[model samples]
Target chain A: MVEGKKYRQFRVNKHLKRLMAKHYALGRYQRYWGRPLHRKLAWITSGAPVELLRAFKIYSVYPEQYGAICSTAKATEKLCQAAEAAGYSQDLCSYARSHIGSILRPDLAPMQGLPKPDLLVACNNICGTVLKWYEALAHLLKVPLLVLDTPYLPGELTEHAHQYVLEQLQNMVRQLENLTGRKLDMQDLKRQMARSAEMTKFWREIRELAQAHPSPLNGPDLFIQMAPIVAVRGSQEGIDYYRKLKAETEERVRRGEGAILEEKTRLVWDNIAIWPKLFNFTKMFTERGACFVTDTYSGGWAAELASGDPLESLAATYTNIFLNRSPEFRARQMIELVEAYEADGFVMHSNRSCKPYSLVQEVIRRRVMEKTGVPGLMVEADMADPRAYAEESVRTRVEAFLETLQAL
Target chain B: MEDFFVGVDIGSLTAKVVLVDAQGQALAWAVDRSGYSGRDVAQRLTQEILEEKGIKVEQIKVTVATGYGRVTYPAEREVSEITCQAKGIAHFFPGARTVIDIGGQDSKVIKVLPGGKVIDFAMNDKCAAGTGRFLEVMAGALEVSLEEVGALAVKAEEHKAISSFCTVFAESEVISHVSAGALKPDILAGVCDSVAARVSALVERVGLEPDVVFTGGVAKNAGVAKALSEQIGYPLLIPENPQITAALGAALLAWGMG
Candidate 1:
């Protein structure tokens, strides 16, 4: 277990281990079963329409998720160095750099790098970096590449923007049909969407249970528990895993147990997990009787699938991701979270690797603090790269933030 | 004997110790280069101050530590410099709403309440550009003593503009000015301007409020002080001993603990 000292380990973690282990094991040995079944493994982004890929029977693997794994495993620095040695700029997204580094130097990578892909799929909803990242992967692995171009939503999702994404979804279906030599099965897609919706609902409900007086979940729990939601969405295994997790979380709430031993200050987190320092960094808070009740990153998956026909829903859901929205929208989202979770304050990671998420965070933080009358702190660090983390500086900021909250 | 409280602020470049009595009145304070071990320097300073004041070690009821070396220092409590600074400022200027503290390695702007509670804050992110270290580097390049930087800078008729935000690049900018036969005071004024510009951006993050109190070691620099006041369009309220405010704040908090 990756659980740290003073942390309450969820019993469902065992089920999660078995579930993720089986998932990775299947991918690691995909050649044996996949070739016989005419299934092709496609490297996909975190924000891609995985339901559509699952419907086409395409085995989807997430390099971004693997980047987090490499980080937690403590192999990201070496992998990122390897990528940097190969002319990738140090300023690029650490996940992209680490993943590309894994490709270039598998010996230095965790799990000897993610299994080779038959094709690469990327969606621009998260960031434009994924498109270039997938393109680089396609070049290196000689695989077909498919991209979903979701327009940025400065305001609400316009009808034309929705139609544009829907058109791309249609085109992607045609491409998948040509690649897999299979017809578009509307029934299969509907079934996949249903499972996806169910899994998303369970994840959302589990997170909301933290609204209990003493939060049942902490930052690391949210980050670690989000794996299945990101990697195995729309799958029965994912649904089962979340169901078990939801029940366990509810039990903790019923018993009034916090993820930490003593919950004094409840906070909301912004940006991706500092995967390398997840436990170590969070320990600074947990030891001080602080618990991150909710966060924006893991909650990204908790959003319900958009309401529409399957294709239209996929287009809207994928296009309207929070990262693609304006700062005002994100600020309101944070304000609502602070009110709902009863958070004393919020901490934004200001992740150096995620421009879209971190760049506008100062604006959002000001708005949230102004609206909610709560303070927000920004800690600058990369989500995957350990090089960018300044331990002393981060500790100072965190301690000061908590001190202010306690003073209030 | 009356109870005495001690606050130690072991910063990156300096270690300071302040002693206060039962009623939160400052009795004695000392400052010295942090050198190889700030904690050791702080301990030595604390011992000296207590001995000088004829107070025994047992008479010290509470000890609080603040700043980068705070965690390592053996104290009754360790508070962050931010909270300490705000408390310190509030003690001296209760109406102060904003604080701009540029220390050895990091700079921060804090918005505080009436009683020194931090409402919000913003600090320079993993960069030495807007800090005292930035000025030290420019001074080293200009062959000027750290103490003389401010005095010399204020003498310049027109300040040179040091455009680079990176300390190393800004140092080179200083060198270029020197090599170009520009006056030393002009280059030094530019250095002050550069630090002020960088810190002003941090101030904007938390926002500039009335009765802005500027503390930290850099607050002693007259040139940067003048530039910052003009840039932010508000006069700064600097303490008599700017560097010891956080230590003073720590001492006050220690007294409060009693």
Candidate 2:
């Protein structure tokens, strides 16, 4: 079947669909073979330390990704209502609220909801909301919860912060050992970290391929493709997938093929993808030949993993995740993206779902515009919930921002 | 042969059309409630204005569409109201460094550059609290006309405060204030002050500049203009026909295209 002309199809989309299908299938039927294979299925946050869990032969499931899937399935409003009925505040993170709703009523959820987890792991490096979210999950599922708290870094990494994160990681190892009944193998962990680092590097390189004129990739492509790196990091399958993507992307760049037919203006995107309307909303830019070459959202997975002892390296790497940093750090990162990609302008998604990413965006927007002399636009919407999206308002702001670039 | 340029602005509550000649002089313009169909209103008004001026459609060199319903119009080109407002204000006041536009559904604060381009801008979130709609709703609740609210508000010697920034909540608050024996003009003054406070927050986001140009339907309200000036610490320069500025900006852009 042919796709619509409104969007240019990516060559590797079929492979991604197959990979995600197989991954979800494995999780859906995990109860049948998981116990025999001695692999415990665990629910985890997107920013949690997955390598440590992988070393114990644990299968990881990302509730955040599943929440996005539910949104794409157009089941978020119903699922969120279920959660709200159960006393969860509507003001809470939509991902968490929806996931909680799915948990309370799996019959109304997609795929009859995710398989029941044997345990839960959460890291506060992403946002403080995860701590409370995972705590609720742990209580409901009656599973042990492992939390690795990464203190917010105002500026440079202090010695106390390093010791604090490393100490918690060391304590987490004992809990994992007790749960899995496996000893911590230093060699096995080293191998996992190495694979994880290589996979992250591959992603970083794939993003750089977009630096080519008429970028080989667009925003939706990046948002969709970065899933495996988050879901199955520290695994050979994830690395292999990225390797093929890198090679394909490089080929596209070499041939001067772009994600869109013509790239008249290059833009940088901030915040998370509007999952429910990803294709529809992105067409607003691609149809105008304004391609989003890079984004801060998916780039969160491409941060280089530090090299050192396994626990200490994980501490340094995960603690400094972009979402946990100060606004100055984010501003500098955005300015660098504008300069590095030769971006004509940038747009900030004032996402209502994620406050840590959305708040202080105006300040950052001003700083980037002042530094780059490129106009910045703010579009208010939610990452997963379609209800928050105001189509006409977003269209006006984006159309205006694009016109500003054309005038330039 | 006469060369004509046209600009059409289709907002949430109203639709406006402006026609200009090759030399950029206004030929004819019209404003009416946008009603249910922005596309229909824009098409009909453009036709009426052209016919009223004895001009043929073929004489139009270019047409630019703007405002909330901009994309729905089949003009030669479409632009953002921010850019259109900046261009429109700059055409009249060459020194306009800031623009505060309070339309029916949304409010915008734009920082204008030297060439009539928008350097940066901030807009109200998905709410009607800080916009012209808030005032219109308050006027209805007070049993006063939209035009009378502003004029009557200026008569209040001591203005009371309306604490809520939400339109629905503020409506109820206004009702209770009236029941509590608060003067009608004082409550109206408070409503204007509330809009000014909300708009001030948006303006602060973009950073204020001197020679601020205030345009849009709300600019005709002396109460709002006065309160906004007090909050911004500078008197606003409202255009003679503030409601048609965005449409004029679109016409100016159309002329530039020609």
Q: Pick the candidate with the highest DockQ.
A: 1
- Of the true interface contacts, each candidate retains a share of 1.00, 0.93
Query: What is the fnat value (0 to 1) for candidate 1?
Result: 1.00
What DockQ results for candidate 1? 0.95
**Model 1: per-residue lDDT, tens digit, B131-246?**
99999988998889999999999999989999999888888888888889999999999999999999999999988889899999999999999999999999999999999999
Chain B TM-score in each of the candidates: 0.99, 0.98
The collision pairs in model 2 are: none
Which pairs in model 1 have colliding backbones?
Answer: none
Interface residue Cα RMSD of candidate 2 after superposition: 1.1
Query: Using alpha carbons, what is the TM-score of model 1?
Result: 0.98
Docking class of 2: high
Per-model TM against the reference: 0.98, 0.97
Reference-based lDDT, each prediction: 0.94, 0.90
- Cα lDDT tens digits for candidate 2, B105-164: 999998888768887788888899889999999999999999898899988887889999
